[model samples]
Target: MTVALMWEARAVPGRAAELLAWTEERARELTERPLRRETFRAPQDRVLVITWWDAPYDADLPELPEPADDLTARPVHRWRFESLGSV
Candidate 1:
């Protein structure tokens, strides 16, 4: 089963760009690479990341951590999903 992990964070005012860069750097240093990875930005200073893995949900993987207190207005949020085959 393929697992998709979504990570999201809301940056403080005027810090979206920095936060995005931080996440990008962290992604590069992951101990275990994902099958695929992508990132997106929202209009209101939010950043989103999606990482796909061939391992099951319970497998251990390097996860994105929260940005420093000064960088984000709130803590990061994460969710996991399992892919379903087409009908």
Candidate 2:
């Protein structure tokens, strides 16, 4: 099975760049390499990171951590999904 972990955060008014850098650094520092990892940006200064792993849906996997409170406008959001295969 393949599992994709999603980590999303919205940065404070002017800290989007810093948040992105922090997220990228943390993703790079993950001890275990995933099948694939990608980062994205969206409106409202939100940053999203997705890491795909070849493991069970409930398996433990490395994930990005929340940034400093001052850097984020709200608590980070995360979700885990089991891939259903591409069309």
Tell me the spans in candidate 2 whose CA falls farther than 4 Å from its real position: none
Task: Point out where model 1 deviates above 4 Å.
Answer: none
Per-residue lDDT of model 2, residues 1-87, tens digit only: 999999999999888999999999999999899999999999899999999999999998988887999999999999999999999
RMSD of candidate 2 to true structure, Å: 0.6
Most accurate candidate by TM-score: 2
Error of 2 at 4 (Å): 0.3
Clashing pairs in 2: none
- How well is each residue in 1-87 modelled by candidate 1, as lDDT tens digits? 999999999999899999999999999988999999999999879999999999877888788988899999998999998889547
TM for candidate 1 is: 0.94
* Residue 81 of model 1, lDDT score: 88
Candidate 1 clash pair list: none
